[model samples]
Target: MTAQLEATQVASTQLDKNTIRRRIAWRVAQEMNDGDIVNLGIGLPTLVANEVDKDVELLLQAENGLLGIDSLALEQQIDLDLVNAGGQHIIAIEGACYFNSADSFAIIRGGHVDATVLGALQVDKYGNLANWIIPGKMVPGMGGAMDLVVGAKRVIVAMEHTVKGKPKLLQKCTLPLTATGQVDLIITEIGVFNITQQGMELTELAPEFSIEEVQMATEADLIISPHLITMPTPH
Candidate 1:
């Protein structure tokens, strides 16, 4: 809450898209467990695949009806028929299986998913999420977000700290709700937060920024953790 923490408050202009996205991805990947069944939502969430630890293996599922996703295909490896929920070319790892939406939703609804990473437009202190649409703008229609949040054992949100200097993490979500009290963790370029019964708690922050910087970017009141850690991003 005070500006004397150590570093200056984060300015929206100080962040770049690629750096912020990758840093968010790196932090989120560290949360996945070995052999976990995971779903990475479209857009920013998909970048998480590039950051998973090499020693930890995970099963990737695309809501578009594919499982065992290996990685985003290289230019030469592209298969016209294969893509993730985001519609990007991907390679299916060996033993990967494909099915229709019914089977895919069944996997999600059946509680087979271990964790799901998604991007949010707004997330509040109560763990409420709203990312599907923005008021009057034509938005990407809600796909499997509602099901994943309700079905996955854990739900993590990957996103930027702010949008053009506007706070996205707020006292309450201004957009349509995706689900209520379902988010477990949220990773942004500036800090990592845990949605709790008390409110949002700052667990970790980028080493370059101070707690003051994070507080300025976020609209909701942040509960400073007793054991906060500094998270350094890979260059």
Candidate 2:
């Protein structure tokens, strides 16, 4: 691709290796149908708000106590009382509502959300997700991950292809798990993989990355999509 087209793609759909993490979150948001109730975990999952259509009727649920939340914009001043689970500033739409954090988790545990997007630290070939504190190492708590993973109708993981330059997807996770066999799909900078009972199937790879390249990156065996297609470059 020409430099100009590359720049256009980055500006339009925000698709590129540098933004791959965000693109995964964006793709997860795009998967939502009208009226779908969705939960977004902290970190990369928070970026989904920027990619969704403003009029799609999708309700955003935050573990901290907000629903139907809107994206924070620089054009608008910050609202101290409105924040997401990560404690980041967020805006609320006209029909948005707030509840207690415990109640918010209850909503998730009750399977009220159609889907959830979360960041993963490590995902095994069997769909097991590990995102909590790595024992003996500095790490954050699981927060609401356990509830969301098992309760959501579907769980999508948005994360980088690697952590500290090592592949995050592997045959097994080295850290304590957030949830067991709950992840449905993983979208990463290298590719999109579907975790099924059989194995990790590669559905799509980043435009500049090849299947061999992705396989070399991960420790687990990869199953390429029979209907594999390259990602569309942004206009």
Q: Best candidate per lDDT, number? A: 1
Candidate 1 stretches greater than 4 Å from native? 1-9
Considering every candidate listed, which one attains the maximal TM-score? 1
Candidate 1's residue-wise lDDT over 95-214, tens digit each? 999999899999999999999999999999999999899889997688999999999999999988776557888899988999999999989888899998999999998876778778
Per-candidate Cα lDDT values, in order, are: 0.87, 0.79
- Position 81, candidate 2: lDDT: 74
- TM-scores of the candidates in the order shown: 0.94, 0.88
List runs of model 2 lying over 4 Å from the truth. Answer: 1-18
Worst 10 residues of 2 by lDDT: 1-10
**Per-residue alpha-carbon lDDT of model 2 for 1-235, expressed as tens digits?**
1432333333334334546656676666667789898988888888888778777888889988888877754446687777888988887888798889888888888889999998888999989999888778865667888889999999999887765446788898878888789999988765788997789999876777657667767777898889987754333
Per-residue lDDT of 58 in model 2: 85
